[model samples]
Target: MFVHFGLYAVAARHEWVMNREEIEAERYARYADVFDPDLFDAAALARTAKQAGARYVVLTAKHHEGFCLWDTATTDFSAAEALMAMCRELQPHMIVNDRLGIPGDLVTPEQYQPSRPLERDGVPVLWEACQTAPRDAALFAAIGEWMHRHRRAVHGAGPSAFTAPSGVTYTQRGDRLYACLFDWPFGLLHLPDLAGRVRFARLLHDGSELRMREIPQAQQAFNMNPAAPPPGTLTLTLPTRKPEVALPVIELLLWDSP
Candidate 1:
């Protein structure tokens, strides 16, 4: 929360009193005479700042009044220290932005999407992605609801984490992986990573089971014995060319071994 309270409050005009009025520093200092400490309640202001979703608050100190509200050696009342102490006592968890003459949290980056998730010391850090969507989130909720309602055999499937190629996304609930295909592939939707991990595959939109085959890429001349392919490069043969729905989602029951 930004509290722009200072000598400007009594000025009744603007915070830039000296600059706008062309008053000298010595003349502007006279505004401090009217500064009434009785009028300002720091604790009440801090409470209001918290209710406004402000994790932190910044106060306007040493404003156009030329009166040093805090950090003064002449008076016992160090307004800066007192105000901050009051804010800390009232809202202990509240962060104080730099405007209060304090060091703050890490520098925040906004309005951009990173190629990969941001991490510090190998730990993921909170980052923002700049993406525009319909202001009404109900559209997204409706789409998710439709997918959940038609989950069918793939409902409550899991392996927790699995890999799929680009343009595809998957969800795991119990023992099944529901792969939502955004674009229709040619003849086969090859899941190279799931070569040995998947036992069965089926179209979740319909209850039709799919046929799958595993082929090795590494082979020699007249290769009687083909070398075993690495994990996550296996291929599955899908029966249907395409599903009737606009976005086709398939369900695969994973296997433990090849």
Candidate 2:
């Protein structure tokens, strides 16, 4: 009720459109227009993302300034012409809201209220709080304390320092000398390399040149599926097969996959 009321309040107060073209143009100026819908044909973007080895395509139908890619009956200035027709013409496509406000009584399944991710504003816990509850200083602080490691957020929280084990070398007794990781997804251990790969093998405590190999990708059990992660962790080890060897340097590489 409060959520609807808030949206209503904001919407009602928003200036009523005086002219349609200006409204659409303003949408772009406000950074509200993300996807032109016309720029990329439906089949084309999918093919391109697949061929480019991109895992996902973020079509910015809307941003903070509030623009939607498709036509909205709600507004006269809604997307028309190019892509609006595509959504109606296309098939086998599914859309999950990139923005799910908050979960629970504040939101209903049909109306949609999703928990916000922190990566948008750059700071995970603390910065995320600013984005979501920017006015609420106490809430952000509490979140920051809860996410001391800063890796606990739903989306990437940008570059923050982390701790790792200390060891220069170890015995790869039979096959591998490995390390352990707790409280993280099995994806790339780090991020922020626009160059598209993370190279951090230099942090190995044991100091042995680490070989980059494709370890079998492990599927996270449904129980571990994340709407959010409970304060949890896991252990990871590598194969070395020696009694004494330089510690392995692990490089976390992020790339889209099939």
Candidate 3:
């Protein structure tokens, strides 16, 4: 399945953008925290999209610069290594908890207390593994053998021996609670690293009806509204097909206001 999600509005909510590229690029896919899970993880957001009936999640991992989604050692401006994000200390986990009301097993202060960083063959934390395996995450796993080495060591080591902070709240909205539809604008999206066809539907009457269709674009995802009006949602999933999926417009013409 494909989806047309809104990002500029979300960036606006975060006070991160004033225009098209500025909002979509710096605040999402290309943003430093876009995939931190603890900070900008897409799983929960994507899950919310999926619960709304999406099957593919096309995002702008990189903007016009040919940058990247995760930490790119190639340049210091990458979303993973952008010192600005770390300086801001944005709490993605907390945001997830707040927006989704995850009821996340209630982590105690002791759990949140800063712990010493771990090392791999004397190397510091690598943002590539993404708290999971890489082969499945080619986007984040672009760090080469060095990343693989550390990850192999960690995966082989198993869960943290130290008492870690509490995590995961099943009561999240992204799962299946309030499946609100998100409608993004074409001007608010861009992914230089993606390409393919998109399959999605138009939401109507409070999402009671879903009409399916296919859209072919070089990009990953897009919005239903070409310009602007009532906001809606475009549900989606991650890449698994041989090629990256495209962003097809999934327009909705209704609003919740009177």
Candidate 4:
């Protein structure tokens, strides 16, 4: 279970309310004055997670908005020490997403960590927050489901050289390659990198096999120059109807791991 609670809760708006609305820092700091989390019971939260069969809970101690949920000597703009102690007691693995002028156990990609070390007790676990509107349950569910389905690729995969149209990103994990398509193409998706490397292709969503073929690059008028490299255009036939998900992923099994 993951929980996000801070001064932003006082505004009853999204987490990035300060930045998205372009409010001044001093003006936005006033939210901390009225921030009263009287109903925030860390023990009750832990009990609820246990009832729901959750293994662990991750609480956002400080978000990108730079509002600290715990009291610190560096800033008076804090929720105070009592809440932080309770949270630490209930949830030891707290996530401090912003630089609060204090040392933290973990650091996110967006944070600047020049003075602090990346790892201390163990390998630092990187946390990536998915920014989404409140109550957008479908999108959240889709993202969580996608991550769960491709847990191996999510952890072990790295950026791939494989090329695709706009809104598409590629990642490869050993013999398997993944293409995350954010925008649905018309009817055909072209991949220029995996010309002869792809052994199989399928949609990850429903395990639907897709038809694919390679076209010689020389066949195109753009490659009229004899010095031009040999053309190997790999195109996958996509379904006319797009899948019902936040993002669609196409899995490619390569003949050789690159």
Instruction: Pick the TM-score winner.
Output: 4
Deviation in angstroms for 196 in model 3? 41
**Residues 27-137, model 2: lDDT tens digits:** 435333332224435675455444433335555454334444456765444444333445446832543332344221111234333233233347443221111222343
lDDT of 3 at 253: 32
Which ten contiguous residues of candidate 1 have the minimum total lDDT?
A: 128-137
TM-score ranking of the models:
4, 1, 2, 3
Clashes of each: 11, 22, 16, 1
Q: List candidate 3 segments past 4 Å from native.
A: 1-37, 65-67, 73-258
Per-residue lDDT, model 2, residue 186, is 39
Query: TM-score of every model?
Result: 0.40, 0.23, 0.19, 0.56
- Identify the superior model by TM-score, candidate 1 or candidate 3: 1
Question: Model 1: residues >4 Å from true position, as ranges?
Answer: 1-121, 124-132, 135-145, 150-163, 170-175, 216-232, 239-241, 256-258
Supply the TM-score for candidate 3. 0.19
Worst 10 residues of 4 by lDDT: 221-230
| Model 2 regions lying over 4 Å from their true place | 1-39, 75-258
lDDT of 2 at 128: 16
TM-score of 2: 0.23
Question: Judged by lDDT against the true structure, how good is candidate 2?
Answer: 0.32
Please, what is the whole-model Cα lDDT of each candidate in the order they appear?
0.60, 0.32, 0.30, 0.69
